[model samples]
Target chain A: MREVFHQSLEDVQSRLVEIAELVTVAIERATKAFGTSDVTLAEEVIEADQVIDDKAIELDELAIQILARQQPVARDLRIVVAALRVSASLERMGDIAEHIAQLTRMRFPERAIPKGLKSTFTKMGEIDVQVANLLTEILRTEDLALVEKLRTLDDQLDDLHLSVFEKVLSENWQGEAGATVDATLASRYHERFADHALSVAKKVAYLATGEWTPDTDSIAVIVAADLAAVRENADGAEA
Target chain B: MREVFHQSLEDVQSRLVEIAELVTVAIERATKAFGTSDVTLAEEVIEADQVIDDKAIELDELAIQILARQQPVARDLRIVVAALRVSASLERMGDIAEHIAQLTRMRFPERAIPKGLKSTFTKMGEIDVQVANLLTEILRTEDLALVEKLRTLDDQLDDLHLSVFEKVLSENWQGEAGATVDATLASRYHERFADHALSVAKKVAYLATGEWTPDTDSIAVIVAADLAAVRENADGAEA
Candidate 1:
């Protein structure tokens, strides 16, 4: 029974990595479509998002079953709970990718990205795909080494997102209100996509580190989580 | 032991409703400050957000303890899981409200919203507060009758959100990129706030009904949830 439980746990982990791969492909295709106004690629990305959704649902049920069967405690329990969260995050990442694709499909032929900002979008798209790749890698290997790199990537995206804003709101800007809106929303999508990737990595970090974050900043969150865990253990003993 | 478990479960449920109420007040003050350009109120909302965060973390730890201790299955497990999701959604709702207030803070004394859309935003704000109130009520009463009201409220917010986009994109628009971006993001915050409330409602409905939703459109999601639950049950029995 113990071996079986671990097998099911392994299955859940692999399923999460699989979903991360699909999410990576979705973001890659969706961003490629965004940069080139490739409506066909955009359509494909949109249609394929259903697969990610189905995988998430399947992974969720598997995790729930494991919980019911083993009633795991401590790190094992955290791992299963984190699996559910990672699946949801990946599913949301896919949905965001689909939304980006929809934006591409909406402006098809006309180009969702304007001419002046194409290179910027190109940069953002490249960085976003890289972030997505990092997500897949980290999920696959559970490597803490890759965790710090995601924050750097997310910081890069934030800088790029802000630059997009500055360019649009610059004194010499000539784009219409519509283009400005498009640029703003699209930049936000890519930035948030990176944010979600970073979020998943943080969850994995917590799982590996055996901590529960009580806040956003890593140091403070870890310290607070440790305090909370100690307090909870005392409470549990008392109860 | 059963009595202790039931007591703990009730404690978890009440904590969730408490978080919901805090979310309610946060949205109310944030939107109120947005309309009036009341920077003080906006600042208050922003500062008060940490309390919501602390409460959510507290609620989550409590739920995790219940799960680890009780090892609940079926409906009881669903309720605990739903509480976690609800706390998350409420926390997110608070964050969005904080974003709205931060916008007000960023554009203080200048009124982040334009005069033309004031009435529209006013209407939207009223509905958002109503939606927030409904969230508090449903979390408290678990009254499925209020469930229908949330969909209606969400539709209202959606309609208002669309109108904001339409007005900004219309030919008469004179606002610069800054105001346009502000309008776009602020409207989205409100729309998403309502969206989260509706989501918590759907989760509660599933808990009440023992369904497993595949998506967010309540009726269709509920139907799909039912089918998924049936399939999962068959899979469990077969296993």
Candidate 2:
């Protein structure tokens, strides 16, 4: 029974890594699509999201079955429970990618990157793809060091996200309402993609570190802080 | 052992209800604060979110303990697992409220609700509060009927969300980039609050109804469809 349970735990881990890989691909393609107005590539990301969703559901079922049959206790139980959460977060990351793709498709033949903020969004997308890759590595290897790297990447994404707002809200900005809206939503999607990856990285870190922290440092705090800092800077600039 | 396990499950249920009640209050205050630009009320919501977070963590610990001790299987195990997911969604609902409060506070001395969209945001806020209340009721009573009502309210919120985008993207929109950003983020927050409640409501409904669906009809699909429909209408207007 002990050996069987260990094997099941391995299964959960591999499956998580698998789903993370799929999310990585989804974000990579979605970001590329958004940058180039490649509607075909965007459509691929939109369609492939279902596979990620299906894999997450399968993983969840496996976790539930392990609980029902193996009845893992103590740390083993926490591992299974955390798999459920990691699966949920990975699934959300896929959805964020799909949302970015949808944004690309919605503005097909018209650049979704907006007129003046193209380079800003391009950087955000590249960072998001990097974050997804790092997340997959963490899930696969359980390298806790990657967790810090992931957080740093997420912070960079947050700064770029802020820069987006700064660009749009500046007096010299000349984009129309559609451009502003696209930039706002697209920047948000890119930032949230990294945020979810960071969250999953934290969970993996907890599993490796045995800290059992329950997401006290949530995305809301980071978002609020980012916004507050940007607003203060904007105020200072005007002064 | 059986009796103790049953008792533990009841404790989980009641604790879920308790957390849901707190979420209801958070959203109620948050939406109110947003509409009024009441910085103090926003501060109250922000400060109280930590309590909600702490409760969620406590609930998670309890659930983990139940899994460790009771080792429930089949439907019983799924119940505890569902509690964890529901707790997460409720906690996220609280975070969304905090986000709205942050927006309110961020724009203090200047109204957060952009001009000409006051009535729309008011309706969205009211529906979000209603969704939170119904979600709490569903958690408390397992009343599947309320789930339908919750979906209806979510639909209303979705329409309002799309309408905000429409108004912002239209030719007549006169709000500056700051107002546009605020409206975009605030509307997204309001819409997501309801979405989280609807998600929790679905899990409760599944538990009560014995259907094992695993979020196949995700928020991604709904959002994609919403954006598609709105863009179609916008394109038609241009044509």
Candidate 3:
């Protein structure tokens, strides 16, 4: 039974890596297609996303089965849970790729992005692919050291995302409302792709460390302030 | 042991509703604050989000305990997992509310939205709060009927969001770059808040039905085309 459970764990690990690889390819193609306005390639990325979704569903089922059948305790249980989250993240990355591809498809023949911003998007695509490849490695190894690099990549993506706004704000920007909206959304998609990658890495690290760090922690202070506000409201009601 | 597990499940459920209620309040105030430029109210909502986060973490810890201790199978297992997902969705809703509050705080004493878009945003905030309150009921009852209403509410938000874009695209858009970005992001946050609520409703429906529909599917055709492309590449390599 123990050996069988270990094999199941190995199966999940392999599936995660499979998903990571597939999504990495998706990002690469989507970015390439977005940068060049390749509608055919964009269509391909959009269609490939279904496979990623199917794979994610498969992984989720496998994890749930393992949880029910093996009843893994402690770290083993966390591994299963984290696998589910990572699959969801990877699947979302695929959807982001699809959203990017959809933009390319939407503006076929005419470039979705104006000429001035193409180079900026090119940089985003390059960094997106690099971060995606690193995500593949992170899933495979679960090495804590690699997570920091993903963070740095995410920061760079943020800077690129910010630059999109800078371009929009520039006096030289001649694009209409449609172009600006598309460019903003496209930049957001890439930035969020990296952000999801960062989130997945953080979850994996949590699985490794078993530490709890709530992103929002000052609720107690907020609660006290809230009570005071309620009193003030009561004072208003009386008045 | 079964009784203990059920109690723990009940405990998690209670915590979920608590989080939902708190988040509902957060949304109400954040939007009110954003609409009114009430810096005090905005600060209150911002600070209250920490409490929402804390409650979500507490619920997650409880659900994990149930999983590890009871090792619930099949339906019960799904129940615990769904609770975890719901907690996550609720926590994210708080973050969205916090973001709305942040925008209000960002432009204190000045409106985050322009006069042209105020009526539309007013409508968005109303729909947001309504959907949030409905979500609280859905969590309490899991009544599939409420899901459709939530979807309708979400559609209303989408329409309002589209109007924002329309306003931005119009020749009369008088807001500067910062305002445009702020308006776009605020619209997105409200839309996503509704989207998340819709997602939770779907999740609850899935828990009830045992159906396996991934929200994003139809990637198979893409994969077949992708395979064909790979083969073409291989053939070219051989040539």
* DockQ of the candidate models in sequence: 0.20, 0.65, 0.19
| Tens-digit lDDT string for candidate 3 (A36-151) | 88999998998888899999989988998999999999889888887887888898899899888877876677786766888889999999999989988988898989989988
Ranking by DockQ: 2, 1, 3
| Reference-based TM-score of each model | 0.89, 0.96, 0.87
lDDT by residue for model 2 (A1-239), tens? 99999999999999999999999899999999999999999999999999999999899999999999998888799899999999999999998999899889888778878888888988998899899889989988999988889989988988888888878877778888778888888998999898788778878888787875466545656666667677777777778
- Is candidate 1 or 3 superior in TM-score? 1
Could you tell me the lDDT of residue B73 within candidate 2? 88
Docking level for model 2:
medium
Alpha-carbon shift of residue A178 in model 3 (angstroms): 2.2
lDDT for each of the candidates? 0.80, 0.87, 0.80
Off by over 4 Å in 1: A213-239, B216-239
Q: Any runs in candidate 3 off by more than 4 Å, and if so which? A: A212-239, B217-239
Error of 3 at B65 (Å): 0.9
Root-mean-square deviation per candidate: 12.2, 1.9, 9.9
Candidate 2 lDDT over residue span B1-239, tens digit each: 89999999999999999999999899999999999989999999999999999999999999999998888987899899999999999988898999899888888888989999999999999998888888888988898888889989988888888889889877778998888888888999999888788788878877877885566545556666676677667677878
Candidate number with the higher lDDT (2 or 3): 2
TM-score of chain B of each: 0.89, 0.94, 0.89
Top candidate (lDDT): 2
Top candidate on DockQ is 2
Candidate 3 lDDT for residue A58:
92
Candidate 1: tens digits of C-alpha lDDT, residues A153-224: 888877777667667656556887667777877888888898788889988988888665443533222322
